[model samples]
Target: MEEVAVVTLEPWHPWPLVFPAIVLATGAVMTFTGHLRERRWVRDIGMVLVVGGGLAGLALLGLLSGSWDQAQRAEALVGLGYEQPTFSGGDGIVGGAPGVIDFHAQRDGELVVGRLVPLGDAQWQVVEGFRDSQPKDSGT
Candidate 1:
């Protein structure tokens, strides 16, 4: 009898983007209302809210930017024929079929490189390498 297992992966949540925007907007409104009412305490409270919201927003923005960068890198890799990309525990896997080829590339102390993985069985081998070539001319 063949055994089958179903694995489900959850989609990425976008609450980080929404939470900060909501907080910032609310804080701005509170600050504006407090200023209009000419209440020092209320104005201070609004300012505090604004600061908190701004910090939260900044944190979320950084996270979003990092995510976007990763996505762009992944897209580029895929475009370059890297298949079945997987990153786990500081290691990455790409392609699969026979056996797995694991390798890492890095430059300097701060410049990190993406890892390339090859897949195939023991008898078969897959390689991950890149070549520089000009784009083909596609007439508009």
Candidate 2:
């Protein structure tokens, strides 16, 4: 048995990320990301990072929406025009809670959230996808 999202939520090729989510699931991703974008003074979430990449986005969506999985991930990789993405394992500290971070390649420079929570006055970490995924340089 299989299921598919009616729309790809294709990035930037730019349309607001808020759209498909309306048809999908719930929680802070829809509520918080948009609010942070609206209230730019919020700094931690204000600078808003598009965590992970297209594959990453697909992963988050797959978890939240439940109707998506490997098939969607593969198609989304194509949609993003990324070839042969190697998916490493990522697990959240809290089960069902996604981690928010400072990477944007997943959304084609658009802001879609993978993690959302109260960043509460902590300094933000801006780690772009390539850097985050790269093995820490042995020399460093």
Candidate 3:
């Protein structure tokens, strides 16, 4: 009898890309319908909705851009360490296990970080480090 181990690594999801489109569409619908009526409150509500939606859309776009930039950084990090020997004790370990290698880049002056961990023995894989910060920076 023989035993084998299987490991899975999932790619990063870019959800922020769709968020702004949803918000903008909803706001446009509200604004268009409200403009058809003469009620002051209706128009006010519509304007508010439109403004809020625009802000939300912009925020989501920023997040999407940042995420995209981080993805590049993660790829670079993985390539840089792909051939390096796994260190037993160093910046890439946590609780005695093979720790993650964090790659960081600055987008619009804000630091974006990603993590790469050893997926068994095949290759250094990108681990879902954090949405906005590194694991160690998260105080975990």
Candidate 4:
């Protein structure tokens, strides 16, 4: 088998789920120990830790998922044969309505503007512009 080089860092990469899991486990152990030892402070601290870790885990999951989704959307847009695709609004998170993003890119010296809408399961629908029109005015 041939070996291929891999890029370790990318937008779609998922955060390490292990750290949050470990934190949750530690907090649970601490809570159980504190309860057994009848230490209210320790138990309270453990509970706080548990809640914090749970929240962090949830946040990480949401962020990673959003990033992944954005990356996929970007890839789909790029695959449309446009060069240097730039998303309007923001990157790494969907803006405006759900499943919609404003984007612009160039093909054959003409700028194309459109909205990308996810058609479920990695499929995307390109809406609006991409006509055979002149470049947009720079409003100089």
TM per model?
0.41, 0.26, 0.39, 0.60
Instruction: Put down candidate 1 lDDT per residue, 30-139, tens digits, no spaces.
Output: 88988899887877887887888889878877787657635544444444445544432323333422123232233232222243332222121223342213354789
Model 4 CA deviation exceeding 4 Å by range:
1-18, 39-45, 89-98, 128-140
- Against the hidden true structure, what lDDT does model 3 obtain? 0.51
Q: Write the per-residue lDDT of candidate 4 for residues 26-73, one digit (tens) a residue.
A: 889889999999998888888988998899899999887776765765
| Number of the top-ranking candidate, with TM-score as the measure | 4
Total clashes for model 2: 4
lDDT of each: 0.48, 0.36, 0.51, 0.65
Give me candidate 2's TM-score against the actual structure: 0.26
lDDT of 3 by residue, 6-117 (tens): 2233334556646656766766776777777756676677677678777886776767655654455445544444322122222544665555555444434454444555
lDDT of 2 at 58: 63
Q: Candidate 4: global Cα-lDDT?
A: 0.65
Model 1 TM-score on a 0 to 1 scale:
0.41
Candidate order, lDDT descending: 4, 3, 1, 2
Please say which candidate is ahead in TM-score: 2 or 4: 4
Model 4: per-residue Cα lDDT at residue 62: 84
**Between candidates 2 and 4, the lDDT winner:** 4
